[model samples]
Target chain A: MQTIGKLSAATGVKVPTIRYYEQVGLLPQPARTQGNQRLYDRRAVQRLSFIRHARDLGFPLDAVRELLGLADDPDRSCAAADAIARRQLHEVNARIQRLNALRDELERMLRHCACGTISECRVIEVLGSHAHCQGGHIEGADLAGD
Target chain B: MQTIGKLSAATGVKVPTIRYYEQVGLLPQPARTQGNQRLYDRRAVQRLSFIRHARDLGFPLDAVRELLGLADDPDRSCAAADAIARRQLHEVNARIQRLNALRDELERMLRHCACGTISECRVIEVLGSHAHCQGGHIEGADLAGD
Candidate 1:
């Protein structure tokens, strides 16, 4: 058994994130020492590593939870996991397409910019007038998160 | 003169988001009626529309604020706006590249998956073992937000 700090070090997940995982039921509750310090075993290490890897792969927490459930039950069909991955892949593709459109629009705006005063700036002009836009680039775009 | 609801309808910006813009100083405080209703003028409509357009192009709030400042001053050089657009383009390109890597990784995982039992699942196996990863695909990835 290792302390929570050691677990964090071993897994490369922050201490608070580990606690959060536990709170969210992603990580199982670990044992504790007499002094009430958290103690993690090898299983905890493996579980945390799996969670981190899934998160790194851009899997949402809900999908990760579903995957963890699937991982726990080895006798179950792998179809569920495959479906989840496919859905994530679709979302990623959609975001890439939207970003590409934005890129094209930005490129077009820059190309037309004279780099003169702001009054004559193509960048400002295009942004100020939606009619100048190529259209349909920003629908359902989560720009703040992007 | 128009009410906040009218402004929202005109600019396609939500009422709460308009208030948020005001709170963040992106939108100037509007005149108010004796009945305590927020009243906006034609300038407010134009300003909000500019903000929406910039946001649609995936500019961050800070960048939007800077662009708004530039727009408000017609005599200033447009170089700053040009630079901001370039920076945003660079970021979008970086994000696209990272997302492509993720897409490649996911495709690889899916292609190898045989639709067998979970015990033989490539997805679970690969996620369980980071060594199976192509490496560096997940570095600094904002998967949760992505």
Candidate 2:
């Protein structure tokens, strides 16, 4: 068993993030030490490792939670897991497309810039006037956020 | 002049987001009708469009503010706007690189799965073992808070 801070060091996960995982129930409630500090066992280590890997790969917390559920049900078909992965792939592909469009727009805006004043700034001009917009940019944080 | 809701509809921006822009001082405080409803001018429309377009190109709100300030300043050199664009381009490139890394990792993890139970699930196993990870696959929204 190790203290939460020690576990955080070993896992390379931030202390607050670990606490967040615990708050979200992704990590089981760890036992407390005599001094009231959180103590983690090997299982906690494993869970943190899983969370870290998932996060590193860009799985949102909610998706990670669903993945953990699917992972816990060993007897379940791999179809669900496969589905989740495919969904993530789709999302990633869409983002790449969007970002590519943005890259092009930024490029064009930058390329034509005369470097005079904002009135002569191509970047600001494109953004300020949608008259020439080709319908590719929508910059909300998440398309699927509820 | 359009009300906030109408402006939201016209721009495809959300109601709360419009209010958020107002709160953050991106949009000037609008005139109020006797009913206290916000009223916007064509200039406000232009400003919001500029803000939204900059945002879609992945410019941070702070960067957007700088660009807006540049637009407002007729005497300021367009170099400031160009600088902001260049900065955003760099950010976009960095994000693309990170997403590519994440995608590679996700692909590897998915490829390694043996279609077994959760006890032997390669997806879970991959996530639970950090040593095997190279990293990719994060949502853009999560990328922002970091």
Top lDDT model? 1
Model 2 Cα displacement at A107 (Å)?
Answer: 1.1
lDDT of 1 at A98: 84
**TM-score against truth, every candidate:** 0.95, 0.89
**Candidate 1 clashing pairs?**
none
lDDT of 1 by residue, B7-107 (tens): 99998999999999999999888899999899999999999999999888888889999999999899999999999999988878888887888888788
List of chain A TM-scores, every candidate:
0.93, 0.89
lDDT score at residue A83, model 2, on the 0-100 scale: 66
lDDT of 2 by residue, A1-146 (tens): 99988998888888998998889899988999788889999988877877776776667788889888887787887767766776776676666667767777777788888988777778778878766556665556352311
Backbone clash pairs in model 2 (N, Cα, C under 3 Å; residues 3+ apart or in different chains), count: 6
Computed on alpha carbons, the lDDT of every model, listed in order, comes to: 0.88, 0.76
Highest TM-score scorer: 1
lDDT of 2 by residue, B34-135 (tens): 999999988887888888777777777899899888888877788988988998877676666666666677677788877766677777777767666553
- Candidate achieving the largest DockQ: 1
